[model samples]
Target chain A: MTVTPDQVLDCSGLACPMPILKTKKAIDSLQIGQILKMTATDPGSKSDIDAWTKKTGHELISYEQAGARYIFYIKKTK
Target chain B: MGETSKRLAIIAAHGSLDAAYPPFILATAAVAMEMECAIFFTFFGLEILKKGYADKLKIAPIGNPAMPVSIPNIVGVLPGMTSMATGMMNGWMRKAHVAKVSELLNIALESGVRFIGCQMTMDVMGYKKEDLIDGIEIGGAASFLEFAGENAITMAF
Candidate 1:
């Protein structure tokens, strides 16, 4: 299924908690079914975002590494 | 489902005044992110939320091995020493761009962070509801756990 884009959050170079915090702020501004594209450079971003998505009940549509950057697609679930 | 908002819960159980700073700092930062934040104060941590003791809180250096050797332990054992050290530390923090505990607490409250006092601890310490700061909610561990469960982040200090 195709997901609709809602917002994009570029969080590269941000350390632990900042990325998560910014992603959260972005998600809060979006409505249900909207998707967010998040990019970050923190080594812990992958696991932190994944865990955050799980705990917050958000849907992590996709995640992949592009060179040194980690990109994630998250959907507002609840 | 609607957008899942980030929420956080911080449990502060330390009796030492300096130790209380971490929980408030994290809570205030969480508030800055506009996340729903709650601080659960338990045990000696309740002192900071007590109206009578809050402003008089002092940083205890006794038994703290990391204490600078320049400050003699004997001096630390003297009356008013902890308060003097706390005041000096507060001044240094202000110079170093670090936020004070009271400032952080105020910011956290203004930013919508919930502050809760542990009911069990209050009873054990003989504190009535009037003894606590205004707007402080009284609850037990189960209540805090319920709030923490819905939060994406949980911290203990």
Candidate 2:
């Protein structure tokens, strides 16, 4: 299944914590049930975003790998 | 995610450019995870609270273990070594596109992490309230201890 995001953020060439930091800010701008698609070049974002989603009660709808980039689709559940 | 609130308190006791990063990193992480975070800057660490100080922070090679190669203590004592080391470290971080110390501080602050300056240190060090960045809560050890005592995690650096 495919899910479209309400907002998209590109964090290419950024390193650990930057990607996570930007993701947090982007997620906060979203309303409940809105989806955010974030693409990051930092490998650490995969786990960081996952943990953040779990911690904040957001829904990690899906994630996909494309070359060195990791793309995450998250829905704001809370 | 509902129950009791989580809080983290950190003591930033050093002022080196490298030493400054850890507290901001931890506080940013905690705030990102939806936990309340506070950082207390004491001793020389209070310098980081001074306006424009983050941009001027330097890593002194004389005692930093994280240097890729060690220089003799006598050599490190040379007048220009600290700036050289700071330049090298800053270059490396920039070459890798890592976020700067100032950027990290901004992130921590914007994330709702409380920044408390040590009032005792401020008095001893001759730092006036106007000398610090805005929104800093100036307090002594007891104030920090109150936050630390209530938190499950506290770290000193």
The model with the greatest TM-score is 2
What would the per-residue lDDT of candidate 2 be over residues B67-133, giving only the tens digit for each residue?
9868777899999999999999889888877888888998898778999999999889998999999
Off by over 4 Å in 1: A1-78, B1-5, B72-75
TM-score of each: 0.62, 0.93
Tell me the tens digit of each residue's lDDT in model 1 across B1-157.
6566588888899867678778876775566454778989999999898875654667766666675435777777998877777777667655644545666676667668889899999889999999887877899988788888884588788
lDDT of 2 by residue, A1-78 (tens): 378789999999897678877888888899999999999988888889888887787888999999999999988887
Against the native complex, each candidate's DockQ, computed on alpha carbons, is: 0.07, 0.75
Name the candidate that leads on lDDT.
2
TM-score of the A chain in candidate 1: the value is 0.93
Residue-level lDDT for B30 in candidate 2:
86
For model 1, state the Cα shift of residue A3 in Å.
Answer: 34
Q: How accurate locally is residue A20 in candidate 2, as Cα lDDT from 0 to 100?
A: 76
